[model samples]
Target: MQKNGFPLDELDFAILSCLQKDGRMSFTVIAEKLNVSIGTIRTRVNKLIEEGTINIIGRVNPAKVGFGAYAQIAIYVRPATLKDKVAQKIARLPEVSFLAMTSGDYDLEVDVMCRDNDHLVQFINEISKIEGVYQTKTTLYFKVYKYAQPDLNLLK
Candidate 1:
């Protein structure tokens, strides 16, 4: 498979599959499972990291961690030119979990997590204060049924 012009083989996919299951999975374990040498697994993982193909990070469930309010906010930025600048400002917010510029009625979309309803209200007030923000529509997620990474096996 080609990723950002870098060629990746079956071994690479296998290694990624193992890592997806458990980010902290050891090179020794992956090597044994894939029937390859430990050095090979280590080298491949390093290469993947350097190429910006993947990052192993601890995933957290917001609800379990006391973040009870989850929301998606659609922002309308006037003059359009300030969209990038506005996005940069929003991205710095710790409560913001995801932010993207899209083509539609709104210029930007943001997903945020907060401790509760009051915290969410405060967050909205904070974002609304940003310069160039004309308006915003916030949608609260009552429940998230599924949240997961893409299945690497599909690449096969």
Candidate 2:
């Protein structure tokens, strides 16, 4: 399927690679790195925002955010209404951070951060009500060893 929102180009990808590493980096700094004018950097950043391809926000580490638990839930859906209404509801829930619909043993995978066991239980109970959802298997993450954005170096 053709995805909507910003159609990324090489320069846009370069800008994103830089900003993803440090969201607070200024336009002047990015312009220097990308060998583009400061004006160009500003335009690209604004376009990214307008197209909904980027949101410059402080992405809190779960530990710092007081999320005592992080879990992944795999959900199986009925054949009738796969990702339509069900995924929409999951996306709106406060605890849900990352959601992806996939073709495999599970129809969807949802990542959630919770304050505690009670919070996790509550989220699980509430999210099950999403239409067309049939079953779910959840796995808690104990130690987050590594999480990194792809380095642009390898793409060279």
Candidate 3:
């Protein structure tokens, strides 16, 4: 593990890879595959979670769940100082599934999920009412080929 990078060893990478493939896989199964004890696997997984190295989560397909409107919105904030505040406000919105402070033409970007076109329009209208938000450009997703976290191979 490098000092400035994520503090993960080979075992940690292997554990993450296994979890990515099957988040519900038993620790015993992983241990058996890695030739480690169950207790060791448990301890290591706990440590990884404690250090914020990995998050075990159940993901759902938004489209299958009736959220058909998926859009990426770029928001331009009036004053640079208000960027964080606007992002926080946007992040609190239920429609916003993902939010990030960005360095580009836009100050912030958000991924929004809505039931349909009407819901999406309403959401965008609501966002336009935010005080510091000067402008917003929305790009609707026609299809999502992939939606998952970064591959564990990058850890190598």
Candidate 4:
């Protein structure tokens, strides 16, 4: 089935669903479970990766890694034309994990991770000094619950 200009067959969707459940699952195991040849599974998996349809990676807990402070910041750029440029510069900051150019009161939204409240303050100060940055509003995240992958069944 092709969705959003991506050509993905049933087998491709199955392979992706399986990997989403357990990214570490071996090709042999997946093949056995799916009742297909191991080589076929391997080829499909590689094709999926090459096509940028899926990515298998390990994710870490930010708090466990000493980044206890988390916040989302909304930035208003001085000129609308500078939004992308400013967002690109902010994306390069080490403290910024996620950045998006938005259309609303704020020109951009950023997710930042820091060691503590002091670190967050320092990071905010650094952002304030960037050119084209007009104003910013930040909301601290006390707890985060993330779902790595949503249920594939919903795609149906």
Candidate 5:
């Protein structure tokens, strides 16, 4: 990678593509799949980590963890302040599983994990009370039949 974040090379992109799909895959496994030495895989993985090209993390299902009700809250900010600040507040809220800035009528979208509909309503009420928030729309999840799986070829 270049100092100013140059586009990744084939090797770097390939490594990222693999890890993005399965963060917990062993270095040896990756090396074999990519037809490279384990040492090379280890070194490249370390570089990717340092360069922020990849993040290896443990992901858990909120529903399986006793938070079955999920809500997607679309927030309309009065003037749209720094998302980082709002995200910090959302992160501190245990029920907030995911949050992101968007490019539409809503300034931010928050994924919340709730125990029930009451929990979801209470959380939305609390979020609406945050400073600078004008309005919010919530979408409740019914049945999520599928989970996200990254396609490595997109990066290629």
Candidate 6:
């Protein structure tokens, strides 16, 4: 892992990988798997959390949780200087699962999950009302085959 420029060492990667698989996995189990002391695991985990390198949280399936409408929206922002301001407004929307500024025809891209098509429509209307929003193209996702976190092994 030292070969890479990333600050994380092999042990850190190993610990993150284990937690990625199961956030609730015990430090003792990780210690046993990685052949490290429980205290070492605890200390490393605490450091990781403090540094904001990792977040331990329960992930739920949006569909299973009553979010039936999933969609991606590409937004065109006028007066590009207000891009950051617009992004801040969109980010505050509870229905938005992901949002990013992009270099393309669209100034911003956002993913949202809603309870139904009506809810999606309402959400879109809400976004359109924000300042600097010129136009938006939304695509509905009927079925999502894969939704997950990045694979840590790839960083190795």
TM-score of each: 0.94, 0.83, 0.94, 0.90, 0.82, 0.95
lDDT of each: 0.94, 0.86, 0.91, 0.89, 0.80, 0.94
- Of 1 and 5, which scores higher on TM-score? 1
Clash pairs, model 1 backbone = none
Better of 3 and 6 by lDDT: 6
TM-score of 3: 0.94
Model 6 lDDT per residue over 1-156, tens place: 443343789899899999999999999999999999999999999988888889999998999989999999999999999899999999999999999999989999999999999999999999899999999999999999999999988865
> How would you encode candidate 1's per-residue C-alpha lDDT over 1-156 as one tens digit per residue?
787799999988888889999999999999999999999999999999999889989999999999999999999998799999999999999999999998989999999999999999999999999999999999999999988999987777
lDDT of 3 by residue, 40-117 (tens): 999999988888888998888999999989999999999889998888888999998899998979999999999998
For model 6, the superposed segments whose C-alpha errors exceed 4 Å read 1-6
**Which candidate should be chosen as best, given TM-score against the real structure?**
6
lDDT of 4 by residue, 61-156 (tens): 898889989999999999788887888889899998889988889999999999999999999999988899999999999999873677777877
- Runs of candidate 1 exceeding 4 Å displacement: none
- Mark the regions of model 5 whose C-alpha exceeds 4 Å error after superposition: 1-7, 81-88
User: Could you list the CA RMSD of all candidates, in the order they appear?
Assistant: 1.2, 3.0, 1.5, 1.6, 2.7, 1.9
Those runs of model 4 whose alpha carbons end farther than 4 Å from true positions after fitting are none
Worst 10 residues of 3 by lDDT: 1-10
- Give lDDT tens digits, candidate 5, residues 1-156: 453465567777777777777878899988898899999999988887887767788877777878768878888887666555666777689888778888989888998889998888889888777777788899999877766656657643
Question: What shift in Å separates residue 149 of candidate 6 from its native position after superposition?
Answer: 0.7
Candidate 1 worst ten-residue window by lDDT: 147-156
